[model samples]
Target: MMQVKSVTRIFGQKAALDDVSFAVEKPGFVGIIGRSGAGKSTFLRVMNRMTDATSGSLMFDDRDVLALEGGAKRAWQSQCAMIFQQFNLVPRLDVVSNVLHGTLNRRSTLASMFGFWPDDDVLKAFAILERLDIAEQAAKRAEALSGGQQQRVAIARALMQDPKVILADEPIASLDPMNAQVVMDSLRRIHDEDGRMVIANLHTLDTARRYCDRVIGMRDGRIVFDGTPDQLTTGVARDIYGADASFNEGATSTAIETLGTEGDDAYAQSMMA
Candidate 1:
């Protein structure tokens, strides 16, 4: 179980995360939704130890996450792996090599720096790529794959960490609707098959509704709602996104269709290039 207690992250006078408290008692897919600057990304970062909370406590299965230092902190970070919007792969490296980077925490610094991956680690990377349905692309350059494929490779990398929790910060924010669906499917599959805790900061309510087992709504750095997807009614969405917000189903569908068309255009352009 992961527990967050009165966690507040203050940036100067601004409180990015204000008195936030929550607990994840079991493994499931969780979606964190909010408008920009609602502290969605900040909260994920604090959980992964990418950023510190100015006050309060974070505990993961009895370990004091906020109090960890040095190697203990590094271990905690590895256990709570993060996936980013940018797909954070080594553009020039092969996909398998990029996935292998996840094992750096468990290996000697000299071995990792020298690119000396053990045979078992290499085999594990292959298995992960296969599980993510990207085994054929394992030897290809990371930059050569489509956006969705790259994100799958990124997921493979995260799995190589054998993490207890996976935190994805807007993993599909840059992709087209088709690719977005693929990436979201991959995340859902991981959560279902592996039973690892998956928490994602998502922009689209539709995607959250489609994939997440639980939805958490935030507004003005505070949690506005927390419940199952069915519990997030249109009225509750209005409260989360504000009365003037345009994040309804109709608007979301239009945006997704537009993004899908744009992604097709970009793919065609890349092929011509």
Candidate 2:
């Protein structure tokens, strides 16, 4: 279980995360939704230990997440693997090599710097790629792949960490609707098959309602709502986004038909590329 107590992050007198507290008692897919600058990204950064909280505590079981340092901090990072919006892979490197980078924290720097990897790790990387249905692109340069494929490579890298939790910061904000669906489906599959926790910062309400086990709504760096997908009614959305009572939740939806492109270009290219 993970517990966050009174976590607050301050930057130049602005509280990006204000007195945020929550707990994860079980493994499931969690979606965090908010307008821009709502501190959704900041919360994930704090959870992944990419940044420190200005005050309060984060606990994973008995371990104090806020106080970890050096090796322990590195270990925490590995266990709580992060996936970013930009698909943070080395564009010049082959796809498989990028996935293999997930294991760096566990290996000696000399071996990693020399590009020496165990045969087992190599096989595991391929296996993970195969599971994501992108194994054929293993030898291709990451930059050659489409945006959707690159995100899948990112997912494969996260899986290689064998992480207890996956932190995805706006995992699909860049893709068109169809690619967005693919990426969201991949994250859902990882959560279902591996039973690892997935916490994603999402923009589209429809995406969250479809794939998430729970939806957390944030406004101005504070959590405004926490409930199941069905509970996210129009009024609740207004409250979360700080809109007036007449706000339409559909405005935040990225449903396939609404986007008009059919999202097929990258979807087909990813398969045949």
Candidate 3:
């Protein structure tokens, strides 16, 4: 369980997050939706400890997440993986090597600098790539893969951390509709199969409703709505986005109507074999 209480982040004089408070008592897919500069990304950064909050406490179970520093902080980061909008792989490195970078914190800097990963780590990286259906691209350079495949490599890297929670900041904003579906499906599969909490900053209402178990709507650094997808009514969405009475939800929807028949079950079966 994670608890964020009275979390407020300041940027110079302005508050990027104002008294933000929420608790995740269980593992599930959560979507944070808001317009630009609405503090969605800032909130994720704070959770990941990439940015410090001016005042607040973040507690994960018995651990005091806010006070962790040095090795403790690094451990927290390894436990709570983050996936960015851009695939943050070393472009020149092979896909498997990029995935192995997830273990950098656990190894000495000198070893990582020399690219001397352990045999077990190498095998685990390959297994993760296979689970994500990208094992064939292991030897390919990270930059050689398409945008969607690059994102899958990013996901594989995150899984190498064996994280308890995955924080995704606008994960699908750059991809086409089919690619977006693939990325979202992979994230969902990770959450379901691994029982990890996946919190994503999503741009589209339809995507949130389709992929997220719960939706958190933010506006002007404050949460305006928090509930299940079904509870996110048109009126509530208008309030969250600060839209006029004429606001239409479909205008912001990028949801694909159908995905390929090779569904989650089939993928799980293949992994089992």
Local lDDT at 69 for model 2: 96
10 residues in a row with least lDDT, candidate 3: 256-265
- How high is each candidate's TM-score? 0.89, 0.90, 0.90
| Model 2 lDDT on a 0 to 1 scale | 0.84
Counted clashes in each candidate structure: 0, 0, 0
lDDT of 2 by residue, 118-150 (tens): 999999999999998999999999999999999
lDDT against true structure, model 1: 0.84
Q: Write down the TM-score for model 3.
A: 0.90
Can you give the lDDT of residue 168 in candidate 1? Answer: 94
lDDT per residue as tens, model 1, 224-249: 99999998776777677664455566
Cα TM-score of candidate 2: 0.90
CA-lDDT, candidates in order = 0.84, 0.84, 0.84
Better of 1 and 3 by lDDT: 3
Worst 10 residues of 2 by lDDT: 256-265
- Stretches off by above 4 angstroms in model 3 are 246-273
